[model samples]
Target: MTEPLIELKGVSKSFGRHKVLDNVDLTIYRGEALGIIGPSGTGKSTILRVIAGLLSPDEGEIYVQGVRRDGLIEDGGQEVGIGMVFQQAALFDSLTVEENVGFLLYQNSNLPRSRIQDLVKEKLDMVGLPEVGHLYPAELSGGMRKRVSFARAIMSNPDDPTVGPEVLLYDEPTAGLDPIASTVIEDLIRYLQCLHGVCSTYAVVTHQDSTMRRTADRLIFLYEGRVQWQGTVSETYNTENPLIKQFLSGSVQGPIQVAG
Candidate 1:
């Protein structure tokens, strides 16, 4: 197989006395869409944070494009082009959609105001949020806000490819949406990867089965802070692995326990 575009070796993280991740190792290949699934408090989103360089691992190493990120002064994104769409649609309430989308370019690039606005409109259109550039996060619906986040994640001035994200990390892209909205977001995720020509690799953390099956070609079942099973999306439904079966079947009786 091709060498992984991003790799986490023996990664472990903790919050105070509670361990969130334990000696976890994962690899994400170029152009692959991977899904991370697990019960609550299982460190699914924590893995994304570590990979995105938002949090440092207590013990372990992270390599992006074969370069270790431990010694990097800034977030490791510069080395591997990492971008993240947060679960909460962490948009700036004070900024309009256009401003939110073009914030990075406005602050970091030499591009003129007109060019930035033009690029913002283009990205909004790409996410199917056309003509909503004037709205603010508070003015949009939940799904619209999520799409705006996606637009920001993919915003890039093609003149300088270095600014674009090659590896996109999504923390529950379909999280609180209704079934219909969730399906729209799921389809949008696939559309972005296949047709939008934005990021090259994606790793999504989601609880929705439909989101997982539709967006990920491969999946890692995270349980108790470690990967309990890894398989193709198709195999996920057919696997006899107890942990997976319990998760897929949504059975209360299995290796997985409900903490009371």
Candidate 2:
């Protein structure tokens, strides 16, 4: 594998009595597409949040580009910029798509509105939504809203190019969408990975089978707060791991205990 971009060593997280991550050790290499897959409530999304620096692990170290992160993202010692695309397409209902996409620039930078708008246009066009900038979040369909969120996630300030996201964390990006909509998001995920000046490395948390197959080159199965299996997409089909078999086949009789 290429040089590691992010590493989680002995990471553990819990909310009260529920442990979401349990001494997990994982690595994300530069330019790799990694998919985190598992049944519901298996801490898939929690891992993404931890990687994105939104949440600090209870008992482990997070090294981004080899520098240990001491606190949450707001504490600001991280070497690389990390962005997150939430599952809910979390856009402001009152703002136009343009405003929503350029929010960071507007709030943090001194760039003029026109300059920010131009940058927003560039990102929107990249996500195949050049003309929807003037529309509200409610005006677009689920897929379109998700694309807008993509544009927002990739939005970067030109004055500080180094601060732009080098790695993106996606949490259930295709969760509520239909199969066709999921495909669109999946295609965009792969497209963004190859697009110049955008995030080339990303970790997507997904339960959708098609999304996992199309967006990720490598797969990690998380169950009961630990990584149960890791392999390529092809290996996922050929492996005899009972957890993987039960997951891929949607069978209730295997080792994976069905949640009541």
Candidate 3:
């Protein structure tokens, strides 16, 4: 196996006394699709935040390419390449789709405005939404909004290979879309991975079965703040482990408990 592009050891985090991640250890190899699945509030999104350098774990260490992650809470991106798409698409209401997609370039690049516009156009086209860059978040459907985020996440890297990030992260890429649109998102995920070559690593956090199956070559199941199971997507469907079985089957009678 290729060496891990990103790794977490004994990673743990909490808000006050409420622990969200409990000594979690996981890793992502270069150019592999790793999907994270678990119950709601099971720290799925938190993992993305940490990997994207948005949140700091109280304990444990995070490393990228053998270098420990630092200044995560203050910066949302990297000079190398770590891209993340938030759950809500998180598009700025005040910016056009092109503006939203190219915001990073605007903030950090020395490129001319016209060059940034061209870069945005190419990204939007890559996602099969070539004409919406001029549109607003409010003007697009939920599916469109997700595509916008997806475009933004991958655009910078592909646009200017120098400033583009090497790692990609997704926070529920298919959270609020129809099955058809969800499938499109999944296809885009795979497409982006393939298009980016082997320098990229992806860790997508999602509970949606189809998304998990379609995007993940391997699956990591988190339960009660710990990694309960980890295996290939095919193995997941057949696992006898109660927590995973319960989750795959969507059964309420297993070891998992639902809190009101």
Evaluated with lDDT, which candidate comes out highest? 2
- What is the per-residue lDDT of model 1 for residues 20-115, given as tens digits with 9 covering 90 to 100? 999999999988999999998999999999998888999999888897887432543455677899999999999999999999999989999999
Query: Candidates sorted by lDDT, descending order?
Result: 2, 1, 3
Q: Report residue 104 deviation for candidate 1 (angstroms).
A: 0.5
User: Which candidate, 2 or 3, has the higher lDDT?
Assistant: 2
How many residue pairs clash (N, CA or C atoms closer than 3 angstroms) in each of the candidate models, in the order given? 0, 0, 2
Q: Tell me, what's the RMSD of every candidate?
A: 1.5, 0.8, 2.1
- Judged by whole-model lDDT over C-alpha atoms, candidate 3 comes out at 0.85
Ranking by TM-score: 2, 1, 3
Tell how far residue 161 is off in model 1, in angstroms. 1.9
Q: Each candidate's lDDT (Cα)?
A: 0.90, 0.93, 0.85
Give the worst 10-residue stretch by lDDT in candidate 2. 155-164
Question: How well is each residue in 6-115 modelled by candidate 3, as lDDT tens digits?
Answer: 88999999998889999999998977889999999899988888877788889999888788877673553444577888899999999999999999889988888999
lDDT of 2: 0.93
Candidate 1 yields a Cα-based lDDT of 0.90
Best by TM-score: 2
How many clashing pairs does model 1 include?
0
